[model samples]
Structure formats: C-alpha cells, structure tokens
Target: MPDSTRQRRPFRREGPDLRRRELIDATLRVIASRGMDAATVRTISEEAGVTPGLIRHYFETKEDLLGAAYDQHMTTLIEMSQQAVEDASQPAVRRLARFVETTLSTPVTDPEALQLWAGFIQRVRRDEAMRRIHRTNYHSFLSCLEELISGALAARGRRPSPDDLKRLTIASNAVVDGLWLEGSALPEMLGPDELTSIALDAIGAILGLDGLNDDLRKELDK
Candidate 1:
C-alpha cells in the first residue's frame, strides 16, 4: 500500500480528536492486515501502542471502534475523490476524468482497501449500525458521481432529464465499482493505465458522450 492511502497521525498526541483518529487509523491497519476477527482490544491497543484502558476511554466497545474505523475508511475515499475534482481551474471534463483516474488508480484501488472493505461488508448484513453506515456512504458516493456526470453532460451542451440523470448515474457508478473491484482484486490482470482507459471508454459510451474517451485520455496523460 502507498503512504498516501494511510491516514496521517499528528505529532502532538494530546488532543482528543487526534488521539481518536489515531485509534481509528490503528483499527483500520489491523483490520486490513489481519482479519477483523483478530482485531481485539488487546491487539488494537498493541497496534496503537496504547493500553486497553485508553482504548476504552475513547471507544466504549469493540463495535464502537469498528464503526469509527469504517467511517474513517469511507471518509478517506470520498475526500480523495472530492480533492481530485476540486480544481476550479480545470474544465468539467477534466475534473470528471481526474475523478475516474484517481478512483481507479493506486492507493484507492489497492489490495489493502479491498480487504478493509470486504471485512466490513461481511458484517453489514448482520449489524444494523454497519448497514446504516454502508447505506450512507454508498449513497454519498453515488450522489457525488451523479453531480460529476451532470457537469460533464452540461459541458457538452447536453442537459439530461432527471430520469436520464438517475439512469446514467447508476450506470456510471456500476462502471467504476465493477472496474475497481476487478482491478483491486487482480491488479496484475491489467497493465498500468489499462483500467482507467477501459473505465473512461465504458463510461463515455454509457453516457453517449462522443469523444469523451479521447478527451479523458488526453486529460489524464497531461
């Protein structure tokens, strides 16, 4: 995993928020490297270099800590996408292309991320809190993608109806999710830049955006 994927820790470790975030990061690292089942209080405390009592001070139960970790994971992914598209100087098309490229590229598409996601996914069905978190994050991601799709279409002088936008958003999300899963699961199957190229092509076709594939390729290459 790249360093960019890992959450940064504060040098001064006295503040509550900083300490809590550190604990969350430690929990995520444990869940990613070892299975979630192995992330007991003792293990997480050892990983965080804190006493189990300190862990209790921050999180009342293991479930609370796990939930926080899951929230952090989802937040990090969303923040990366937002940052990629936040350059006001860039055109809408470039922003959309950057969003796809960043989502499909390293760190975000890493094996560690896949493992962490899978670990939480297995529990979402049985845990009500986990299910809620999953729903919130999933919809938030879809909403962001929909906004980007709308911008991309408008950039080309095409304004989609609400129904059209809904359908297109679902399809575009499927393209990103499908490619992300495959690429993360078996990165060696595709060479560098292949997954992003495929994603841009498929998304462009789905949205009926002619020349979008080429446009995105040029945007990413630059």
Candidate 2:
C-alpha cells in the first residue's frame, strides 16, 4: 500500500496568525486525505482543531477559502524553489542540485501536496481564480527552472536555443512533478532521497552535464 494511505502527520496547534495559517494547511490536508468534494469547511476546521465558522471568518465563503488555500499552497512551494536558486553560493552544478533537492524532497514533495494539487487541477478547469493562480505559480516555477537549466547548460558549454531552453524547462518541470507524485504515492520505490537523485541526474543529462555526481564529487574531494 502507498504510505499515503496512512496518515503522514497530524496537524499541530500554532499561534493566532499562525493559527489561520494552520487552518489553511489543514485545508490542504483535509482536501488531500478526503478529496475536495469531501473537504468541507467543517472538516478542515476539525482537522485544524477549530470550528467551521472560523474558516468563514477568514475567507467569508467556501470558494474564497479554497482560492486562498490554493494560493498559499502554490506560493509557499514557489518560494522554496526560488529560494534554492537565489541563495546560490556554490557552483552551477551544486546550485542545480540545490534546486532539485529543495523541490523533490519531503514536505514539498509529498502525498498531501499531490492530493491537494490534484484537487486544485480539477478546479483549474472551471474556476477562474484557481486557473489564474495555477498559471501564475506555474510560470514562476518554470522561470526558476529555466534559470537553473540555463546555468547548467552554460557550465557544460551547451548553447541551447531559446526554444530549446523552453522545451527543456517544460521537460525538467515534468520530471520533478512526476517524481513528486511517484515518490509521494509510492515511497517504497520513489523515496524522497532517491527521487532527489533521479531528478538531479535527469536535469544534468538533459543539460549535457557529464553526470549528476559532479557536485558530490567536489564536496568529497575537498
């Protein structure tokens, strides 16, 4: 059975500002564990150890709450990916690994995220706000990915065209997203650590790096 079949972690209590944040998080968890249709405000509130009215208080409506939850979920994930690139004090290979590591690891790359993503993907087809949020976050993640791939290409002296870079970005993003779903759903096979390595290796290959071990080799040789 997928590890996701079991509870990943229980939502814990937090401070007031963080309290609402926790509720939003609980929304994702509830949506993940029970599907969006079953993820009622009461259920999310219960998951957060709060009352349903609290959700209405913050969001004023179920649709509003769903939109907020979607935004928070994708934005936080984007911030983590962007952080990995912007905080680069290492070589391009290491920086690229950092991007892969930050993205394909636990917390961000988990069943809960996948479930919430699936739920949101459905909404994106008919929900305007959800579609806009999804597209914005998608571009942001893609842009960062493109930068990392471009850096890898430059490091390996590969002059991929603009179209090539765009295609590479899409492919690499698919690799990461696919690994995320697989690793989250089937931890026995696609565990976080293994997925991280697989993602890094794939990126390196597409960008024409000799292999994904360059960063690790440099560290060990130091």
Candidate 3:
C-alpha cells in the first residue's frame, strides 16, 4: 500500500534582498498608476503578491518603505547612466556622447520615471531619510559626469583645474537635468534625436569640445 501522506515539497522562500526589491517595485507601480497616496502597505502587498504583514516585517513604517523605493529608483537611474558610460573601447568623446544619448532616451526619460520622481521629490524636502538618499544619488551622478567630462577634456588636450572641473560638472548636470525633465514631462515637444543633439552640443560647448555632436552623428551614420 502507498504511504497515506507523502511529504510535501519544501516551500522555496524568496531571498531577503529580492523580496525587498519586489516590494519596492510594487510600491513604484502603485505610485505610478495611482499616485503616491495609493501606495499603502495593503495595496503594495497586493501588488507584490504578499501579505501586509510581510511588508511590515521588512519595513518598520510606511515612510521607510517609501524612502527605500525612492532610493531604489534614483540608484537605478545612476546605475543605468553609469552603464551607458562603461564602454572603454570607445573614445572619451564618444563615451560622453553615449552617456548623453542614453540619458535623453527612453526608460531614462520616460513619463513614468518622471512621475515616479515627482511623486518622491516633495517628500525629499521634508523627510530626512529621503533627503539623504537624494543627496547621495545626486552626487553619484555628478561624479560620473565629472569623470566623463575629465576624460573627454583630456582627450582634447584641455585639462581643467579642479575648481573649473567642478563648475563644469555642475553646469553640465544642470543642462542634462533640465532637458531630461522637459523631455519626460512633454515627450511630444522634443524627440529623442533632438534632445540628444541639444545635450551633446550644449555639454560640448561647456567642456570646450566642439565636435561631440559631430562625432556622435558620424558614428551613428557609420
């Protein structure tokens, strides 16, 4: 006779990091589709296919989860931007050009990304944790830009002083941020090609590298 009760297969539990990320992703989706006010524990749990208690187990408070989500969102943006600048085989100018092109393109400049950012920006002003995350991510992005700018300028035989490089990085970041905001908020107003061209031209002029746009255009043509 067969055993009356076969042992059930052991359940596979999700790793802590993955579970946390899933929760954060769920939170973003809820906020994206229905605004930040709808991203309650219960709602996020439903989206993540877990119980509200599971959320509480991972995050002590709703604000903590929100902060985590914001951190994840900003960190992902910085990472993608870094990845865009990672091709060492390309010349520094082309690398900088790629960085600008990727930043101004889809996913990075999507309406949903803008929505997610807008949803978190207000909280960043009031919440200390959120503000810290913002500052850290902002600096990470600036460092990447500064590195690319340094390489590009050096390639052109123009090595800027540290102070000058600092100013240039800030200015370049401002241009990219402004254009990114406009492109994301009003996608119809400027296409990706136009945005990339304007960013490359503006940053190139700032860094004294006049051929960035031309270089990128030539690469694309080839």
Q: Which candidate is the best by lDDT?
A: 3
Give the per-residue lDDT of model 2 (tens digit) for 1-222: 122344434545566677667778888887878899977876676676666676777777788778888999899878877786685667777777777887887778777777888888899999998898899999988888888778877887887999989998898888888888898787777776678778877876766676665684465478
* Pairs with steric clashes in candidate 2: none
Q: After superposition, how far is residue 193 of candidate 2 from its true place, in Å?
A: 3.3
lDDT, candidate 3, 91-209, per-residue tens:
99899998889999988999999999999998988899999999999999999889999998998898989999999999999999999999999999999999999998899888888
Model 1 TM-score is 0.90
Clashes of 2: 0
Question: In candidate 3, which residue pairs get closer than 3 Å at backbone N, Cα or C atoms, i.e. clash?
Answer: none
Comparing candidate 2 with candidate 3, which one achieves the higher lDDT?
A: 3
The top-ranked prediction according to TM-score is 3
Instruction: List where candidate 1 sits over 4 angstroms from the true fold.
Output: 1-13
lDDT of each: 0.85, 0.78, 0.89
Ranking by TM-score: 3, 1, 2
Model 2 earns a TM-score of 0.80
User: Which parts of model 2 have CA positions greater than 4 angstroms off?
Assistant: 1-22, 47-54, 220-222
